[model samples]
Target: MHRLLVVLCISVALVAGAEQDVLELTDDNFNSVLKQHETTLVMFYAPWCGHCKRLKPEYAKAAELVKGDDPPIALAKVDCTEAGKETCGKFSVSGYPTLKIFRGDSVSQDYSGPREANGIVKYMRAQVGPASRNIKSIDEINKFLDTKDTTIFGFFEDPDVALAKLFVKFADKNREKYRFGHSNDPDVLAKYGETEKIVLFRAPHLANKFEETNVQFEGSSESELSTFVKENFHGLVGHRTQDTIRDFKNPLIVAYYSVDYVKNPKGTNYWRNRVLKVAKEFTNKATFAISAKDDFQHELNEYGYDFVGDKPVILARDEKNLKYALKEEFSVENLRDFVEKLLDGELEPYVKSEPIPENNNAPVKVAVAKNFDEVVINNNKDTLVEFYAPWCGHCKKLAPVFDEVAEKLENEEVDLVKMDATANDVPPEFNVRGFPTLFWLPKNQKDKPVAYNEGREVDDFIKYIAKHATNELNGFDRSGKSKKTEL
Candidate 1:
């Protein structure tokens, strides 16, 4: 009995270890496996990618769920960094954890649905047939609506219609979120009380008794259909990942509130409800999204907002990558005012990575984005500017030397300035590509900023400035003493 118990424990352990039912494919056998499996889902991943690591368990669970289907759907993975580099390259896998579906040797489609076990399984099952189902009877249409959370039905007069084909393509991309079916039957069309050639029906939830809400497309253009679906279907946008955030496009306003939906549901609702009220006011102008503090710390840092503070932070980004933070408290009135200022171009954008100086006492006057045009562009004195990033080690090393150079040239006509390139946007003509990049902007010749390629020592800077300056060097000597002649 003891031996039998030990054997049973070992068998359970083995089964648990074998839970990863996904097939591992190499460059050699990838083509052969694709040839054998009629429908296969391939994931191109890298070991170092965090997203790929998170997707592994979910993909394995999906694999286990669909391993015994009628034609047996196959889930395969290839490590792009290793033996599968060629295979991944052939598929143009630019990003890690790219999923592609293969239907025999002739067809391949990029999978762009939700990255969850159940979502993946549902999408793969849908891909086994045509993107949109053909409903024959009213009972079939009702049954289909009952199964899906959201169902879109296209009632077409004929099977080979243009709108029907467009609806199928749209459904194929969004199968994870919506179910699509088309009916040419007069009985099915009559049940929905539609006479138009193309009509879209949005079936309500099962809890709501599947009440069908629909709209008719008057125009046959794809853009008209797409706009109708986008405007009506996407009720609210919630950003959970970076990919979803990017989908919102530029000129997006995201509310980074501290509320745990799982732990403190009330707090979450209170925060989101406040943002939702403001979101509704400007829905047509900008995309409004709510992001939990923990899930969006990286984005917060990128936009130069603090997520570890007491109050929630609101941030907006334009198409040009310019970021703005709302200084006012989280209220509907304050948010509305903030958005108004943003749209009116009254708000000042700032870079988070730049260091704010304590004072301008040092010889090098710190230039920031706010005063960049005033200090550097409008100044009458010839300016030697050092564009440096705070995190650069080489820039740190040169700080003292730059300060000394600034002191030596203080009495002269030239002004030595330092600007944090990471935080400030220099003029386009400056072209600061690297850290500790120096440029000499002549007094009246502001448009022609000359790049400094000489050594980083004080002597090298002094010589370079003296050589290029329009005025004579008066108060300083090369050996750090008062002189009459040019150093």
Candidate 2:
């Protein structure tokens, strides 16, 4: 009797743990199963793919939640490595874990959405019918807002307007995360205080109990309008678009790269695996973003960078009107250092373009990007270098003052130099993200270069140089007075 009870308990536990909500389909039964269910979400997956393995549990959980729906949405999976090769090939399943929805044995749509259980369930629910609803009356507006956490409503004079069509397209893509409605009624338009053709309505929820607020769409382009909606709706680390740039209030760090999932799966993981790690660490301090190189070509041109040449360029922008580009190769360590400097207010602002300064035959020597190491690193003398841009008004003011200070220290063993940072690259240690950045390199090769942030006056420069010079100055004391000091 005891042995039989134990056996019965083990059998019940095994049956309970078994996944019954999801159907396991093969090439033989794939067509037959689709015929039975009105709506079916099919996942074509390979056994060896790591991403597919990670997605399995989440997909199972979503299937269990969606099993009890009114229409009973069916969840099914096909192992392409085994018996579903023909079926997978039919749907062009190049990547592992490809999800596609079949409706009424004819209509089908690809699912490119969040992979979490809740996200999958919500997305499949939206696929049951048209993602966005058409609002016919003012009473419908009130009822819709009451149910949804956030809803974007488009109100136009006619249903055939270009904006309405654009709104529908966007709605279909993001229906899982947001509720969308459209109306051509004049009373509904007057009730929502909408003068434009489209507006986003933020409904009152537990987090925000305030009344609904309307966000008007002011841009003419579809990409611009779509970007605005995404930025307002999504969390941190969203896709960077032209419209989103204007709404960036906090410091932003952007990674521009091309991700090819088919050719290199590891490269596609670079954004989530590598970049997101840095973003998570500094979630409060900055907003991290990834933008496709092709989509943001014009924006990249404004920063004086060729997005095509350098794949995966990292850049930083702050509210203080400073823009900085990473000088070193892309790595976790390099990115962390770049962000740390930005937070510490150590980086210099980047400029678009600047002409090379003419050799004015002054005491200050000129350094270029190619010869930076030859001039500053190889030299034994203590060096004071000014990294400047030609277009900077502040740099223009400091040029004469720098020349006078260089003239005063010509007789000393110290070397004074200036370089056009826009035209030339400097070492990563220079941290030149702004105009007229100054650094003091000590004579001893062991010592690192120190930024000179004191006033740029002739006296200030002389005092700093004298203090850091290797040999004792004959005319200046420790306090920069005219008292002679011994070596």
Candidate 3:
């Protein structure tokens, strides 16, 4: 009976492995195949990967199933054991069954875990980035700690009942953001226990300031250990910075914290330290404070604020705008990291509510419109003036775009103004027949606006401005070809 069962299992495995054709990818046709297909599933696997070996037939079955539903997703495998070392490194593949999904040219999602064919099929169907694996090495763990994103790192002696309970307690609430891991090696545990010795073992050349986090924990209960770990290490997670936090002179106030907030004095103290560390980095860049004593609302009201959430709030503003950046556990590293991201033009601010200014249409005191005054235009300086009504859908869409354009052109001497055609204050003679016609007055007189084209062409509009706007301030980077900022 045992022999018969073994034969059946092997036969089933063989049939499953043969279910789909696996394309072998080399450097040659990788880009072409990826570009040509709507959806491509590329697996980076190694011969030594026990997980990969098990996942092979499962992947083949998944490919067959997915193909049935969606013209089939192309399945290809790269053997790290063979000649695909560079390919694995390019994708940042640290583990096997590293499934990357590409939709045309861009990678949409990635997966790494114990996945059967059905599991892979289900994951592919959802088309989301796979759940990230836990950080293994102490270096990787430190990186997670320093990340701006909320992170949880679990240190378990064994994958036993107690550890399982801890995971069950927090995993649902924290999910992929948290790290759950363990080490049975006594040498590994002893090093990470009480000093910089573990850090030296993990990262030999780490700087002193960076290496200071290596320490000991004197606790037995899960709560005690949790408190100790978070208090000492939680603040390393990423945070919002002064640059992206606000442009307003009115202090960029932020509340730093761990995403996990335990109702204890120690936990609170830990949270406070993290917030201060973040605040200190942007000392003069903006004002700083913590949400201790639940005084967030009081402080916000006193200073005029706009922010999101209670855990880690960052309210920033200059003279004119007060905006909120993100809602997560905060830290100093994150605040500075977020600032660096903003410098890279990667930080994105979302609009939750629009501010109702006292004078929604304040007088255009900056410039007065005169009749036939050569319809003042400039491209070297991108000037954008829009005629619109608040009720119109098209106007609403264009309004956000206009706001983005203005933000992007903040220091570029770009004249961004809006005229309400519906308002009685403006002259009736400024007869704009259409509801929202944009006037792009570029610096170059040759590219003058002869007529109005009512359509949303963000790229064209930016180009028109760049060409004509006289950038006397040297705001735009002129080193490379003119790259229009996508507002």
Candidate 4:
């Protein structure tokens, strides 16, 4: 029956992709087929995944655009559940849909670019380009630097210089993340310098008088070039948007305000200038960026910053995943103070915890972020934690069944705890990605929690506890029952 279902899923996927310009790959031909193309963007996905279904048409459109790509960049898919189960397992694809770039036998990299058709086409095209674009005229130089992308331009007295060759190799390797151009023409070299040198033109959108418009790469090696680019890429005060947030390294101190470069460039720089002053004070301690308030207003609302006036809200998140926030007027002095306190661990973390319950002695106990350590982690009992979001429909449906299970196990030395995940800061130990996530933490083995992936019915929970619980229940059976022991 399971084999039949797998074949059916593959058939369905193939029929859906028949009209689209996508390759249906299987374990049988996975290795051989990928080697046919120099670059193939293979998506290891399950046919039943909702996200993969939505991304199908967009990926198909991208495949059509790249059909004519030189060195042959093919967009393909592998149904992980059936045809490509072994192939997906080899690549360690744990998710429903995972996109990876395969370049022959080379180490595959995650396809981190945009998912839409046009964006995917542009991104892949960059992968097949010359190491660096040729800059013949000064006009070409200006035009290349005008883009929102960070561009690297190298100028050498002779194009065949050792430095120029090194630059080409570096550009070839990092073309996916940055744009590169070069000119050996004396006219172009005269504009910048007569000797071989590289200038990293930080994106135009991030232009400010606070820092140099173009930074010099003083190093010779590729590793040094990479370090210099990553360090100065965002400028002194980085303008972070939704697209660029993940790029910023942690130990980040970001100020959220009106950061509009198109409309109010001067006013945008005004707030940024203040942040830059403090940013300069702590150079290597933390990375500073300014995000648009309107862009991330919804995120701020979740942090209890709604209706808080337009004063720039300062928030910091360290490498430890702990979050901190300060909604106050910024000054060169106070902003520095906040960052110093954060570094010193003097500030209390800003957690989205609901107020601790005065009475949590019920069968099903409520665990808030504020009281989670006391009620769940530090307690001397085996616990079943349900991290749920209030808006989740699945959590709503599971409520009655979960409560009934709690009632049945009330006499046992176990905690059946539920928390509103939305209004709480879960510890990093519990990676709660979705709604209605359940975990079983044994009293003796609190460090390692087992996820409850069994059926939602009471019996399933009882069976799981019986097998894993630290102690036997009194008079009640291990398999969630009252009266006499069952096994």
Candidate 5:
């Protein structure tokens, strides 16, 4: 089954250019591409997928049919066998030649089985309705404004059977409101058909806006299905997007720079306290939270912001409209005032957030260092050195806890230092594979900073650190007594 998917995917990619509606998805541009269009037809495939290979030609024929002057749909192909693990995982694409249709940024339809062109074409017309215009490229889809009527989106791969199920459910319910379709076609990728799925919509008279309510085709047991919906349904709830974000109409974007540990004596507390006061004042009308110190970039990307070097910039727009966003520099007061200004119809002189405090201007006692030696060294206490990038989300989620742990152990027996791995240098010798890697080194043996713990849990990591610190201070071999069973 996997091999079949791989074969189909590679073949489809080869012919993707022939179909204007169809597209190829990669990690670098998948989100941006989807954001630009309304819907899409995707085929998750791999080079090794034999079933996919067989489906390629059929998919191509479907693409050609859908590219007619009045063709009804578009098609796309996703090569999951490459370095697209993250992209595939995000969409919960588990199998090859998994057919799915994305409406806005979420999956609106999906398909599997019977890899034939006619079968695929029949499915597309049934789901999205007859295409109003012929389109051959994603660029053309971008140029084409969507109609006001029903639209169909499709994707296919063998492992995406569950995704197909969700699409089928939505299609059944909204048959008149919209047409959702898919197929695991062999021989070609339905590029033009896929592209049509995105730009076409039900005409306003025919469009049932009332039926556009939240119809969650989801459950706890169907995580993969939900993920597919989240990534493809740009307007779905729990998955933030320009349209979905409108759900938080009177929302507040909180921007905080303090690490949990450095929040207090570091005088970052002044701002922290002030933010709480501001948060309370606008509690009913706004929603906000502190950003992860490490996840600055991810935050920016998630919210579709440009830069995050400045302290957290609170960005608020109509929860229903992300396009009309308001961003302000540090301080909850400034942010509140900006929101007031927006509400008041004064849209000029918006304040930009302050850039990160650098060098002598830094608020924290630990200054940003360029190299290992520049990292502060302590002898009496164990040292916890964290190597992190400024863009990681998981790292951001763990920031507060990391800070708290350091603050609790401060001055007594441990030194906590943070290093910018991307900006400075992280040697391969350290075996660091991912971001926010925590290295624990005994104060006595400063040169060898071994990998301590990874992942997001704060309490578990703190306990592990304390245990190692105790051993180091008691004149015991810090690396002694292997925990692993000896052969």
Candidate 6:
């Protein structure tokens, strides 16, 4: 019976491993297969990793699509623990499921593109051809210009010159972000300029009353082209979506609203026009953009706000990445005032807090956003506060031990406090890098909070308090013990 059961388990494992759509490679065939294909995307993963498990089905779906393409973009995987450990180490892969694109003669680049099936398929298709497409005539130039994304065209009479080579190199690095094409036709080159000129044409839907529709560049380096494209890609009030948020440079002011281009285009522009009015006044002071409220709801929730009616939400960030919120209702006047104050460094940032507890004098005092100043910052007694995330496993283990210490020192001269770091905003002076971060706020020097890195036992807390407390304790000794009152 034992032999029969072992045989059944082995059979099931073999069946599951054979069903993978992606080709499995080891050190022996890895380089051979990479050299065989024009473009191959490889995922280096381990079987026991949770993230790799979740990505298994998504990768399988993408592999099926890429294998059917004209040039056949090979989707392959290397099991680092099974038979490919040496291959993973050679590539310096330190994480599970690291993706890299291998083009035959070119240097391999990391694949930071999307993870979903359709998005990966689209991204890989873009990599199948040359970095920039070759436009043979005026007809092909007009066809290539018809795209939803901003397009760049380099008109050169000769394709083997230095400028053409530089343009292709830049496009090779940024082709995932924008469209690039080059034309050598005399008819097409005559329209722009006979000289070699790079022209950036803005998207039609991105047109506005502010900023030019197109711009020509005479720069010599790739960095200058990057700067020119970034500065001129979007109009005055940039049409920002979730995918393009990282492109907008700070200090940035973003307007979040119910913007639907297909369902209600007029309403989207109505608010965009209002934001443009304020954007023009602060020109060059900061970058301005608008994002869809529903799409941006998760991030706004971190700022402690919910989706209220159609009234738009306004938020700004400084160069330091400190966030500022607008409290008043959305209006041209209110928005303009908020921008002026934010740029002038006068607006108070929004503080996120839960409702203060009705009675916080328990053994372990609770510190919240509303009472942080009263309980931890401005209090006269020494405070040992724990900033913790509720979902953290380490914090859950320390909860009962912390309660015991607080009860043991109920009559002492210090306060034992805990705050939910997720639900409340911490001050800038204290940095909480991980869960269950503890800090000691000594008396009179309330501004300076010393970080606590001692043990987590009841004795550890008591001893730390005894040595760091500003006022001597009445009920405890230096060794963290109860004082004797025998006479």
By TM-score, the best candidate is 4
Q: Give the per-residue lDDT digits (tens) of candidate 4, residues 172-203.
A: 88776677889877778888875789998888
> In terms of TM-score, how similar is model 6 to the real structure?
0.69
Q: lDDT of all the models against the reference?
A: 0.74, 0.73, 0.51, 0.82, 0.52, 0.82
- What digit string (tens of lDDT, one per residue) describes model 3 on residues 1-487? 9999999999888766665466677656677767877777888888788888777877777666666453346777888767777777877888776888788746777754336664455445434232323445666554545522233334555656564345445544333223333343445455456321111111112112322434444544557655654443323222222212221234344553333233453554455555556644654455543443242454444333344344555544332233445444455566667654543446553333222233433222122232113223422444566777768788888776666655655656665666554431222224467767666555455245433363465554555555555563344443313456677
Provide the lDDT at 115 for model 3.
65
What does candidate 2 score in Cα RMSD to the true structure?
19.5
Q: Model 1, residue 334: what's the lDDT?
A: 93
**When superposed on Cα atoms, how far off is each prediction in RMSD?**
8.6, 19.5, 22.2, 10.4, 22.9, 8.7
Pairs that collide, model 1: none
> Residue 466 in candidate 5 has what lDDT?
50
Tens-place lDDT per residue, model 1, 184-268, is 7899887777544555554332111212255566767767766766654533334334434434656778888775644765666
Ranking by TM-score: 4, 6, 1, 2, 5, 3
Among all windows of 10 consecutive residues in model 1, the one with the lowest summed lDDT is 203-212
Off by over 4 Å in 5: 1-92, 95-371, 376-381, 454-458, 470-487
lDDT of 2 by residue, 47-153 (tens): 89999988887788888878778556888899999999998888888998899888755438898766867668777877776777777889987887774245677
lDDT of 6 by residue, 1-487 (tens): 9999999999767546533658788988888777878888899999999988877777877887666676578788999997999999989999998999989623378998877665577678778787677788878877777655678878888878888878888889987777788888788888767757788888666666866767887788989988988887776788777557788988899888888766887888888988988998988899999888887887688787776478778887877666898889999999999998988899877777888999887999998887988988877788899999999999999999999988987887788899999998887778899999999888788778899999999888888788777766777777777689879
Using all chains and alpha carbons, the TM-scores for the candidates as numbered come to 0.59, 0.42, 0.26, 0.72, 0.27, 0.69
Local accuracy of candidate 5 as per-residue lDDT tens digits, 136-215: 44555434424322344444444246555555555565443233434344321254333111222332222222224222
lDDT of 5 at 200: 24
Stretches of model 1 off by over 4 angstroms after superposition:
1-21, 26-36, 44-73, 79-129, 135-153, 160-180, 185-188, 197-216, 229-233, 236-241, 247-251, 257-274, 302-313, 317-355, 358-371, 374-487
lDDT of 6: 0.82
